[model samples]
Target: MPWKNQSGGPWGSGPKGPWGSGPQPAGPRPPDLEDLLRRGQDRLQQLMPGGHLSGFGIGLVALVIIVIWLFSGVFRVQSEELGIVLRFGKYVRDAQPGLNYHLPYPIETVLLPKALRVNTTSIGMTLVEDPARGNRTIMRDVPEESLMLTGDENIVDVDFTVLWRIKPNGAADYLFNIQNPEGTVKAVAESAMREVIGHSDIQPILTGARTATEQAVQQLMQKTLDHYGSGVLIQQVQMQKVNPPSQVIEAFNDVQNAKIDYERLQNEAQTYANRVVPDAKGRAAKIVQEAEGYKQQAVAEAKGQSARFLKVYDEYVKAKNVTRERIYLETMERILGHSQKLMVDGPAGQGVVPYLPLNELTPHRQTPATTGSARQSSGVTK
Candidate 1:
């Protein structure tokens, strides 16, 4: 056995103890550089093939260290990622998704950003949940970002989301140019949306103009980002909430209802006019046509009558005495055509019994027998 002391060790565990001094505290101690170096040198010496190590062994050790150092530069880029290679802290080139290698870290490095992924930045609000209320999800509004001024000098609350992505060819700019890409995108989106809203009326924004506003903001954001070399593509600008402030919503709704009622009344009046005016016009046209027909008929009748009178007058003018005699005979014939009359004898009596009423002599006929009185009263007989 080796030499033993009171402490049951080879040399009584020496004054400094096995590690360095007496029993140390239980906490971890930092490594000593010089002590580690010595231990490594001793181990190296023992690992040599012979009893002593040589230059060739040192060379082999250095080669192993260099290989490990070189291996440290190798990395893998995922499918959705693009690797930006930087050399000496300056951009060099881009690497595709695969096993890629760059020189060791001090000489070269890589930045892997998800270029193929789409990202969203909200302009107006943040989402939160209320566990106390059955975990109901809600939008917690940031009034400073949400409220905007309109062209008509009215206040409106707007909530919107912007979808964007890093351009494939512009990943380097996205990484290097902008220090805070998310924050920048958010600020730009808010500014663009506010600009568009500022040029729009509050009523349209709260009603039918949401789509137009989204399109305008998207265009503005794209243009602004392109100007800033942000290398961000604006996919869409969508409005989640656009409304008049709660204080004025009721008034706005009333105005909208009134507008609708006014439009309805106008339409009804137009419809009535469309129906009644056409009917009235048709009736007026019919009356005018009837008047024209009556006028034509009266004019034609007057013309025919005048022509007949003229013809008759012409005949009368041609033979006055004969026409007068014929007219007198026709007038007497017409006056006595239906009357009962008896013939009386002239004073020169040519009949067999001139004063006798021949018809009254028959028993069937009655006659007034005042022939002498009748002869005295009658001026002439035929």
Candidate 2:
């Protein structure tokens, strides 16, 4: 009734409907299911030898399809990969690196995880793409991750990398136990590093304790991961940089230089002592030995003088007059031994005779001849 309207059957006097003249443009329409079914059946019959699809032909086609589906389960695992098989979304077993099979499709599936691949995670730094430099990636510092407190109540900046890999026998745990493996590794590494830094002094951390810190953090990370069943093997922990906070770095360097100078001065003083002490000891020993020699010589000479005096006293006591005359003669000989001399041979009351123009005459006399002549004359007079 709506189509048969008053104005020429609602189409404005056109026998062809809403579309205007020149051959109606085609519009969308639902597919004919019966036609499609008939065409498929005709194609199946044509493929058969007798131009009809028998029960046997249908069964044969299904068998071929089933065989192809069954063969689809076969897969190859690479040398570095481990295949994990799951049944109905539940873990079933692990497969080695070779040709392996599992139940096909919805019944079972296999996951290929790279068990031997090494992964690197960096803490305290991030890679960012630089568009100005032809899209190359550059490292950018993450201060929040890098800054840590030391045992000496100092803030230090530390950057490091962690090398890790999935355990060969624990690939299943690696895949299923941890949901964001890389993120978990980064968090654990940062936590471990902070713990180590917190227990260390700032000076050692910045200078000598880098390797120790790395080892400690790596061991701690491994332990924590194992406890969580993360199945991650820690290969190495590498420290990139450790330094005082930027604001205080210059002052820290100045302090280090001062310490180095102090040590240098100490070493120089020790060296001076090493060189000078032995020489002083040697001089002191020489002086002491000389003094000992001098003391011994003086004592021996005094003892000899005393013995001679006692012998003379004994002689004098035996013959007093003769001994006195001999002693006077000996005293005269000793007192006049090295002097120019003249002898007076007159009477006892006579005064001394004039002394030697002879001495002046022989001013260049040979001393041995003069002394011998004097000694012989004195002996004759006695």
Candidate 3:
């Protein structure tokens, strides 16, 4: 609202202003600086009861204000915290954990951050575990972060968690070097995971190679953060879930089952072969041994007979007449031994008659003798 005087002119140019010289305004006028100061002094003297503003009164007021201003600079840093001090918006020094002091606000300040606390960055999924629910976890998937490509040009879903903490001696860098430490850690974690996954096949990621993958990601994240001077130490990498995309899970299962079946069949066949091959080889060796033995026996017998025949031939060559007579006698003796003989002697002009032994010709005895047997048929001669 615009102020006006009695003559209806504006207050700045009116004939009576607040000073009662411009236009003679009747209502309460705005107090001047000097009037307000005098009134404040009067009120202070009245409130003091028996005291007045002597020589030391103003000095005491200044001393109390100074004490409060100095005390305002005092602060305590907890055991787990690292205090970063800044003077006039410029970094001064790092304060140790304990009671510490600095210049009052606007001149120096302190930033206390928990340097020993372990922080976690979860990629792909966030898990909320409920203690009342028997420690069951509820997961919220972040598909944009989780989906990754594998080395074999396959899509896989990877859920992992990165455990990290600010370096104890590097807290200053952690606080001042990076604008957002948590965001940097998370971005590095996601990038490291992707790089590892991109170099690996889907089969190993989904199966027994998950541990190796986690370690690789952790190492890569540590290297990357170290390079960027992030002052974050990666403690561990934990893989929660590694699997094929949902759309291809059924197909992947079917392929895995087929591979298992094929391997089983190959193992069974190899087992059967392992059982039969040795036996067959053993039987073959036995047969060959028996044939060799028979061949040796036949050769030994043939050699013995040839040696005996050669000795007999040498004796026959030494005494031909005596040997011929002796052989004839032995032949006759062998011939007459197994047969019953009847002699019939005739005159010199008549031919010799052979005698037959009808009594010896029995059914049971009517058998042919082998050439080498000691039995023979006989004929009589003059």
Winner by lDDT: 2
- All candidates' TM-scores? 0.71, 0.73, 0.69
lDDT of 1 by residue, 1-382 (tens): 1111112332222111112123211112223335544555677889876758688766665665567557767878888888776565466888898888877645665667778899988877997898988999987888889999999999998989999999869987776566567888899999998888899888788778888889999999989998998889999988998887878889978988999999999999999999999999999999999999999999999999999778868878999888789878988999987444655555555655646667655646325676556545655345
lDDT of 3 by residue, 169-220 (tens): 7865675566567778889999999999999988888878988998999899
Alpha carbon lDDT of each predicted model: 0.74, 0.77, 0.73
- Looking at model 2, which ten-residue stretch has the lowest summed lDDT? 18-27
The predictions' CA RMSDs to the true structure, in order, are 17.4, 16.0, 15.7
lDDT, residue 329, candidate 1? 94
lDDT of 3 at 177: 61
Q: What order do candidates take by lDDT, descending?
A: 2, 1, 3
Evaluate model 1: give its TM-score: 0.71
Which residue pairs show collisions in model 2? Answer: none
Candidate 2 wrong stretches, greater than 4 Å = 1-58, 341-382
